[model samples]
Target: MKPSKNIVLIDSSRPIDRDHLLPLGRLRDLPEQIKRAHTVVVTKCPPEMDIADMFLWEQRLKMPAGIEVQFTTLKYADPLPVFPQEADKRYIYSKFAILLTSIANPRHLRYHLLSFYKISSDLEFRDHHNFSNRDAGKIKRWALKHNKALIITTEKDAQRLSALTQLPDEVKSRMFYLPVEAVLLRSR
Candidate 1:
């Protein structure tokens, strides 16, 4: 099937291996099959990323010659408290934070966290994990234990939390989410 335009976006941080994660890592189409793409985007690029990074990926992805590769970076915005009424203090990342993440690749968030905050603790969950009562209990314990630590999560997780009723008010009050935007870095 032919499409009007073909743009392939591959995560820049994906480990270069077909069997990296079994079924999840398996590619639907081979590099040769995607040679017709008009644009190949390297998503989740770091601010310090260079054009040279594309050269390494070229050897790994084995793309067709002259396929334009564009780099994209995630720009983070200020942390927004989940419960405005209860969370009176604004998040100041320079203080302390405990990262709670349930995403495929959290390195982008981790990068921003490291730059802006002193990480007190980090809790990683399966991608798209739904928080339960027990999960909330654990989070509350951590937050209360680390009196000064601000609980942090991604905007996606924050969205998911909004639908969950099991998490305690205490945990919700302290939790905050950082919003991020993907910006394309035009090639020179």
Candidate 2:
């Protein structure tokens, strides 16, 4: 398929440390991709990951003219505690579905999580360790419901969650791994 002129690519994977950014493999030819991008957004965890450094790298590479690079951090406010109970199951199920299936904004997964999960303005669920089997079950049910169209998730999360055998067949069938690739482009 031809690349969309208005398409926006997002990179939220970890390993952004200075050490990881070196070795040329990570930095090589990135400016070319930036040139092709109309707008590039990097998603990161606030306080933990510094985006300024990434911007500096982009500047050093002399990014393509007119391409805009932006960054947004995902923040956790409060936990949306879920207990394994009959009455709360449906709500919890919906919350899990929203968390796993939706990717409305490439820059802020937290925003999508909050709005889609019906998370109270005061509540936030950031860490993956907070998820329970009950939550996974909900996500499984959602994947089944939606026919699981190649469920797209960050490589880091996929590495962690793909080991769960409890995931339904539908969920597994539709799972698609996203491999990060830098698209190099020549100056116009």
Candidate 3:
């Protein structure tokens, strides 16, 4: 199936991965893909991002003149419990957090959380990681060690973490996920 036009999406949250800015695995084809793109959407950007910097990105990416470039930022909602039944609501207000992430880039979420809480520890996993029982055990142990700190994970990882039947009551009580949605920033 051939699309009428291609829209290339670039994540503005992280540093450029060498020449190709996208987090795709096939690095060689990305530049060509961007060249064919009718519009380029920069995702996960901060709302207050400088307009001049956006133009700089265009030059850095070598985007062809007249190609439309748009910017977007991920807006995060209030923390939601992974296991509502076991969740202790007070943990949501904790001053410290332990971050667990299985996404390609967690820097944006980390930056957001730093505004409200002191991140004590960070646990990172490969993108789309399947949570194993051992992984659950590790998290459970970590929660046990830091009983007062809120255990936070991205909305995507929360799905996999909640599916683990072996997670203890303690872990479930302290764990929460922040839901995120992308909002486009209009060029001034």
- Predicted structure with the largest lDDT when compared to the true one: 3
lDDT of 1 by residue, 1-188 (tens): 86987888877776345334446674666546667787778788777776677567666766666777677888888888776666645555438889988997787798788877888998888998988767877777788887677788999998776666666666666788898899887542
CA shift of 101, model 3, Å: 1.0
Q: For all candidates, what are the clash counts? A: 0, 1, 0
User: What range of 10 consecutive residues in model 1 has the weakest lDDT sum?
Assistant: 15-24
lDDT of each: 0.75, 0.44, 0.84
Q: Is candidate 2 or candidate 3 better by TM-score?
A: 3
Better of 1 and 2 by TM-score: 1
How close is every model to the real structure, measured as TM-score?
0.82, 0.33, 0.88
Runs of candidate 3 with Cα error greater than 4 angstroms are 13-17, 20-33
Model 3 over residues 46-99: C-alpha lDDT tens digits? 778787888777777777777888888889999999999999989989999999
What C-alpha lDDT does candidate 2 achieve relative to the native structure? 0.44
With a 3 Å backbone cut-off (N, CA, C), the pairs that clash in candidate 1 are none
Q: Say which prediction, candidate 1 or candidate 2, comes out ahead on lDDT.
A: 1
Q: How does model 3 fare in lDDT?
A: 0.84
Tell me how candidate 1 scores on lDDT. Answer: 0.75
For candidate 1, what is the total of clashing residue pairs? 0
